[model samples]
Target chain A: MSNKVIKYILILALAIIAAIVIFEFVSNNPDKRPSNPFEFNVDNYKAVDETLISYKETRQIAIKDGIPGAIAFSHGQLYLLVDDYLQVILPGGMEVFKRKLSEKPNCIAVDRDGFIFIGFENRIRTYDKVGIEINLSEVASDKSHFTALAVSDDLIYVADAGEKQIRVYDKKLQQKHVFNGESGVSDVHGFILPSAHFDLAVNSDNELWAVNPGLHAIQNYSETGRLRGFWSKSSFENDGFSGCCNPYYIAFLSNGSFVTSEKGLVRIKIHKESGELSSVVAAPEKFSNGTKAPALAVDESDNIIALDFDRKMIRFFEPK
Target chain B: MSKLQSRRQFISGCARYSLGLTIAGVIGFSLTNASSQQWLWQIDPFKCTNCGRCATHCVLNPSAVKCVHAYALCGYCDLCGGYLKPGHIARNTAAENQLCPTAAIERKLIEEPYYEYHINEELCIGCAKCVEGCSSFGNGSLHLQIRQNICVNCNECAIARVCPSDAIKRIPADEPYLIKGGFEHGQTL
Candidate 1:
């Protein structure tokens, strides 16, 4: 063969070999794979428009153990349950009271009278302003997990995720009634808590709002277990709760707006009383991937107090 | 024959033997050791939707696929989403209370608020029940992977052909097993 022809053929063979090697490397390597074909991408829900975000993180108080359980804001005093201590810190960042509990608290709530109500796994313990254990109530049931607590003037409500019911107690911690969400109303879907993320909050009107996470709705029930009213939005959109269950925690502003925290695509959002999207408090970027939802509480000044569970810090936000 | 003809014949004989050895070496290399060039069916944990086909589609009676735990990514929650059934009342060892149908997962208390979970591959049916629960509620630490020892390594994987998520693909069998790297989507190899 001519030298020119031989050279061209050799070059062609080399090119084919290189192509085969490249193809094999790119096709077989997991890193070179394309974006997942069946990905459940709810990442778009994390993005928030600048105009819709009404709150900005102003400060963060890192807990001592760096492991926060739950938080409750009452009368400008921040009540944080971290490790085994119920720390009551003033608005000025001064810890006025710190009580070591018998065990780690699952949830915490403070009434207007400065009574701290702590919910353990299966029981409720109340401490008066003088740090005296006022009431110790054993929530009787095998499957009674006290996930959340809400205190009103005359009553205290506990969300039992295990039993999927709301246990109502009087001021003396006596079992008043059980609201199982089974009522004459046709719209009541009851409290469907899939995981352990059930939450309870008393709004400005003293109406108990329970997060039916599985239904992705906030339900309102009377002290007698009557379904009063509820607001729910279940979707992947900014206004709705997503995933199997969400809106892990919910609080209310003085203006009666709802502040909610959700898992999956972790976000802190505000909703109107009528369940309309008000504004974004903190978008998903504020949290790490696979982070549990932050515990939500609005202080006396309407400052949004978010206990970032993954970060182990208390982040305070204010309306823009 | 002339000297030149004898020399040409000797060179031709050496070239033929060299070519034969090269071909034999190539065949031997492929038969014993799977070189990097080989392709084997593997499930990408990132793309797997846990559609429940891995257990049924495999030719083996007990499917080769199994659930794996990424210890680094585990949250060690007392109420593990992977170990316990959804809306489970108590964290116990009851078969009905467990998420796994085969009861393959063994849960041991690590401390007050943490628990460690281990999967028994013998009983695991590759149903991906635990993987789905963990991914949805907790960290996506529990992921589905094909056990190489159990896999017969079929030329055409039955599961791959019908993977709902199309997560199963032919990967280089250089790595022992596909493990869930983390939330970042990194792979071991």
Candidate 2:
């Protein structure tokens, strides 16, 4: 071959060798990345101090067949909404009755008469203890979502997350007046429901309280749409509510303490009547990965019942 | 020109024709039935560790992978975790307090407290800084996803090969995204 031909072959060979070496180097060392100056991590928030947790796991009841929806405690019995079925279970885990429901319900509340009031997406339905349909309310409006229901002596208050307002109903499930969180009170921006996690509960005094989750506080309101008082604390510390919206779920203890559940950090806490953090019922570490807060309810005995959707069970927690 | 020579020649011709027919059939079948089942690389948001390798390892200049917003799962908060950096002093849309390095997130006040967020795909670098902050502090409405329209669909995904948690997976074309949803979808993470 000519000298020029030999030189051309050598150049081509050199380029091929260089290409192979570069590819091998990149594929073998995957961690040779550029340093990141802007750093943030969620793992730092996952750990909770032992001193903060004040409750222990007492017992757990497994729901095997269907997806657990919500739980309500009334008259020493636990009413569970699972799939399209409403089941009643005793404190000892003995099932009282299982009856088919027409459709899935967003929430459930039981009155002193043991009549279960079911909240669908936009309307309300009531059923007797024997599973007989008592009454059904008219649809609130277009695109109304009833996320929570609370029963009083003569009124049933519904927290409509869609409308971002509270609706009052008569004993027959007939719609009465609506409270749109406009108390005209100073600094009172009324229900700041960012998502569908708004909750409502009737205290022992028949007083009405609603969770203004976006504000990380529960507001006390009268049946006549007046803001009486509220207490709020937002912090990453154990004593305060954290995340975009917290106190995602709530139930009242017999003594009027608040059993609250937070979603983003996935912790359950008890707050005193004045809205001071009482103690930790369950820490972030207690729940499985990808889990937020579970649906919360307190029985007559004040046992904190957490409906664990991730674990497919209702966990009972008592003060340690 | 013997009988043995004639028989050998005929057998060779028959074998060559059979091989040609098989190759043609395979090519035809692949064209007809392989479109719908085509697989695409996606990040499983549940398993992703937010390692920030997606922005570095992609072959493209600006990675085809971008941030996705699930509005149904969003809280529409004024203090949005995905849009603002941690320890933010003011909740305004100041360039300094934003989490995204590229200024890809757009925030608008829909009402007194509710804010709507939109992703400007042209500016996103798939750095996952916003995703990390959102997943840690909020309902996790913002997550990383490979944009189908922008992706070149390489034979081997560069980011997937170097993923630490192995969160990247080959999902069907019909279901290309792995968006995170709440209990109604039977998923929390």
Candidate 3:
């Protein structure tokens, strides 16, 4: 071949290689490639005004020894689970009684008859009004990590986040049924507990409410383990729950409203029975920004009690 | 084969040489500009929710995000909230008693009640567990900052994509860091 022809061939090859390299580089650029624009606006909800919730701080109880874990209100008293001890305190922050547990308690529930149900790592324990321990671990699975407990007139529900199932029990603590994602019921899909923050509460109408954190939803289930319905909002707005898994802890008010506490954006919010955001019980500024979700409970009078994990205290808020 | 033909050939050669030099110069200038234009990832501390995504979502094996101690804000207490777990009884330096899962914070006795806490950046996973504890109970001195040297400076930072609070942002090469408390005096380190 001629030298001129050879030079032209080499130049052509170099141009083709450069074009291929540039094409690959441009195509792979993450910025140029179409991506789902993150819809949630973080700046809009950064600092919400505290006045949105018209509630007054009625009382504050300092928990000096242990960090607050789980909280419940029953029989006109407050039950606080701190470390391995369960302290029963009066509404005025006076300690009425305290008892130690053999295992670390992850959650606490109170029955109408003054019975206390404490859920440990692998089992459940019941106690009578006089502080007598009753064994209930026989029905628990080996891998159960009970994160929340709910008690009704004749039923008991334990939220095992580790197993991702809600174990139903009778008054005698006998296992009745296990509800999971594949429980064969249409709306009774299993729990999506990403972290150990699953929580459930029995509302005034006796309907069981469970938090499906991964979906950012508050689901309602019947006593028979059938799916009733669910309420969820996933906006960065104050009305909705945001973050990986939030509204981690939930409680029901006397009027069937839901009180929820969320981590990451640490705030306490009150939602109507229809899942409409009624008011803010406490703003994010009221609590330290870095604290986890606070344990929440509502008394019979509709007073909201928050076990502030950051401050290590119980704050009572009453409607203004 | 005349003298004029020879002069014309010489001019043609010089013109070709000039064109080659111009092309080379343009390529070199573009390469220099591309290399000089550097970008660094910065986290706006106020916007950071401490969601713990920095630890797992980073491109590096161990996250480039490290817990930075704002010495100006640190109290340096013996019972440092960032160093020890809440309700921890012992004041000694033990692995189990420390709040940090990786034990990255080093506590040294500077005086009677004061202690000097240093972060071992190599061991930090940027989980922000210590930052949470410190901000909640003690002074908000401990915070997470992405180290520019360790970061690969990805075009689209993985952590920023997943950050729930939208805290991460890109800054110019001159201002590489967004250290807390350093903004008042323009300190980058």
Candidate 4:
């Protein structure tokens, strides 16, 4: 063999061996997920009560606990969503408490006595006013993207994003009734995004006013799961449904008047009795500028408590 | 002729050994470099959109987002502008007057006149309510930082990529932070 040929062969052999060793080491070591899985023991969670820390002279209110735009106030206490955790603001802002649930909480509601019920990802958890978790139920039969929830008296209503149906459950968590996307029944196909800002509210008439944001209307249903009526056609032209995802949050006032927050235009409109919008609570100021005003509640003073998505804070607004 | 052939053979053997050594050294160098290189996610706070999704959408339960304070530039008052709401507390401490929603921001009396504001990151949800107030009223003393201890360090962190502010950036794990003064974005450098 020629000297040059033999030299080239020896160099190639050395390179191959080196390549093999490097490949072996690289293949042996791989990126692994965190070995310490996060523990969800309720004990690991604590509440940061803003109310206790400092004093305010003008507002006279001491501290306001942080709440997600998805919150419900019951019996003068605040039930706030703080990043998957639920916090309850006590009266006088004295004590603030929290409960870490097994699943992320999307919406919360409380009865007269302050029993808290939370819904998220096709699951429902009922907690006492003191932050004690009571019941956890997987309601949606197919786990079909449970989006919105509303509880009244002894019944709990759920909106499924996956299926175009609204399922009703008794206090015992039994499937007493189900409303498919019928004329009167609210469904994703006929109403709003099944997951949009809790589209369901139980009114004094024992009828369910389900806000169908996608449909830009409110479908009414009797307690017996009967189709009663619907308000879809808007009286005002520009006042009609504003966003592709129409009314995300629906708020009802004392005199049976109500308001809806539109997503696309980022505005809030008041729906008159004739199924027309005449009052503009918050007009669209800019494009895609609207916050996630998903949860809406009316305080005793009739002020609106809205979860502002852009602001990342709870905004308090008075009706004009 | 026989002597010439022997000399040629010897030279070939030495060349082969030299080539082999050179090739081996090159391969070793490449392998060493590959093992030491690391992949990381960086945040450019400048592009951050301040989307509320950071609070809820993270895969981590608490979402590694935390509230950070710039103490060097802090106003250091008994009543911090960022820590308290728009109004002053009654001549004393009142729950409704404070600005912190979760009460995660703790205050300690550093002196009779100066106060230290510390954030309990575990309890902070990264709502940025304090950040808004501080930057607006105080010297932007409070800010949000993605804590590495709890961060899962995903192959592609959603917040870092989506941040409209472009405030996040990857730093070496050994020295994994880019500290700033009170408020640097719009405030004086």
Which candidate should be chosen as best, given DockQ against the real structure? 2
Q: Write the per-residue lDDT of candidate 2 for residues A1-320, one digit (tens) a residue.
A: 99999999999999999999998677646466555443564455656777877789999999999998888888888899999898999978999999988878889999999899999889999999876787999989897998899999999999999988999999898888898775334554578766666799998889999998778788899897888988887766677776676778888888888889877667888899999988888988888765357998887668899999889999999878
**Candidate 1, A1-320: lDDT as tens digits:** 99999999999999999999999677645466454332334455667899999999999887757478888887778888888888888866798888888987899888888898999988899998755677899755888888899998899999888787889998788898987884333564366544555788898889888887655678788889877888877665688876445788899999888899887668999999999999999988888875488898887778898888777788989977
Number of the top-ranking candidate, with lDDT as the measure: 2
Greater lDDT among 1 and 2 belongs to 2
lDDT of 4 by residue, B74-124 (tens): 746543546666434331246686666678888887644346788988788
Top model number, TM-score: 2
> Candidate 4 lDDT, tens digit per residue, A219-313?
77765656677777422133455322456667666656666765433555567645675565544442133335435776665565666656555
Deviation in Å, model 2, residue A106 alpha carbon: 1.6
Residue clash pairs of candidate 3: A180-A190, A181-A190
Put down candidate 1 lDDT per residue, B1-189, tens digits, no spaces: 545567788899999999999999999988777544767788889888777778877999889999989887675655566777654545689877688888999888865444778999999989888887678666678999998888888988988876767788777767656776633454534
Per-residue lDDT of A181 in model 2: 79
Chain B, per-candidate TM-score: 0.78, 0.85, 0.79, 0.69
Clashes of 2: 0
Q: By descending TM-score, how would the candidates be arranged?
A: 2, 1, 3, 4
TM-scores of the candidates are 0.63, 0.78, 0.57, 0.50
Docking class of 3: incorrect
Model 2 spans > 4 angstroms off:
A1-40, A43-52, A183-189, B1-53, B71-73, B85-90, B93-111, B120-123, B127-129, B132-139, B161-189
Clash tally, candidates in order? 0, 0, 2, 48
Winner of 1 and 2 under DockQ: 2
For model 3, what is the error of residue B51's alpha carbon versus the real structure, in angstroms, after optimal superposition? Answer: 13
Candidate 4 residue-wise lDDT at B23: 100
In model 2, which residue pairs have backbone atoms overlapping below 3 Å? none
